[model samples]
Target: MYRKEFFVFEQGRPVSALIRNYERKDFPELIRIQQECFPPPFPSELWWNREQLDNHVSLFSEGALCVEVNGEIAGSMTGLLIDFHLDSPDHTWEEVTSNGYITNHNPNGNTLYVVDISISPSFRKLGLGKWLMSAMYDLVIYKGLTRLLGGGRMPGYYKYAHKMTPEEYIASLLDGQLKDPVITFLLHCGRTPIRAVANYLEDKDSCNYGTLMEWKNPFHQ
Candidate 1:
């Protein structure tokens, strides 16, 4: 089990936070974080269940991570390894993640595919999400993976969908004309946009579109 302890200030008070591998005991908190992070209209049925959480720790424990702040679960991130082809990177989240079961995780695969990252509503803006992302980058380097990839949501796109196409909206994001809650954050986290994928998820806010993003491991050969 990987473990790291760090401190972040919340309200000018230093709070200790720990990042570690997921345990069966953390399942309920994980589900709660999912519900709090993604509420109604985002699809309640898509929340992580007991079965999928079990599969995560069993199949790829290294990719299942959780962050606790002051003894409370503040955020979590799930990932799976896969043999990604740069030439043909288009795929829905369900097809890539096995509907969140991650049963298809490839131990020898060269890419770490992020399945989800959820932070509790109360934990927002505390840098916990970035710590989780940084930990995944560390995992990629530690495992000799080539890159970290995921289909990032465009939750802020719906506001512009009436005036622009998905492509244009993404372009605007890149050009600094617009900013998407998910895409912008990914960009800030050192990921680059690969392309826009349609029907990537059942997200009304994104109009069922997702931005494929990647962060290459600088140490990988």
Candidate 2:
């Protein structure tokens, strides 16, 4: 997969990139970006490996996307459709993703499951994350899904973990003065926290808890 180099400098820094469907050749860069977004003690197993990522891209090519900035993969996002009943029981990341292959992806499902959305460390604060999330919304509407459902990491909970339960932490973040960098941004995108999903991953930063977030397509009904 050969890519032509292109650069656009603004104030001594590269500009935000465009989001596009994931390519087979971007897997290596995607793996690297995952490493940079997450640090040590956060088991590598928590992330999608080469084979798993390849499987995801193969199964749902349109759902997998990469952000290219200065000819580099600066961020990426992956998703799949699933059948979910809001009144039914809770779900774990594993149950929905089948450990990341998304083998359970239902083509006629009503919900869009966002498997992962990450940005390169160097590309932080570039609004790339927001762009990727917005793209997910576009996908749901385009595919005519009823809603979007997925785990939202409580990255800011690490600092408050010892003092607060996952529920309380998220409650504070949503209702109180607490502002979580990730959760807040997702909420701003029209997704609401549905519940606390336990053991979403080995993320110490999020206290191993993830919020079940949802966004209904207003245009659906």
RMSD of each: 1.3, 3.6
Go through the candidates in order and give the clash count of each: 0, 0
Off by over 4 Å in 2: 1-16, 161-165
Residue-level lDDT tens digits of model 1 in 1-221 = 78999998999999999999989999999999999887986778888999999999999999999999999999999999999998997899999999999999999998999999999989887999889999999999999999999999999989988989888998998999887788999988999988899999988889999999999999988
**TM per model?**
0.96, 0.86
Candidate 1 lands at a TM-score of: 0.96
Pick by TM-score: which candidate is best?
A: 1
Q: Global lDDT for candidate 1?
A: 0.93
Q: Who wins the lDDT comparison?
A: 1
> Which clashing pairs does model 1 show?
none
Clashes of 1: 0
Task: Give a tens-digit lDDT track for model 2, residues 101-206.
Answer: 8888788888999888888888775667777777788888888889888888889999988888988988897786799988988987778988887888667789
Off by over 4 Å in 1: none
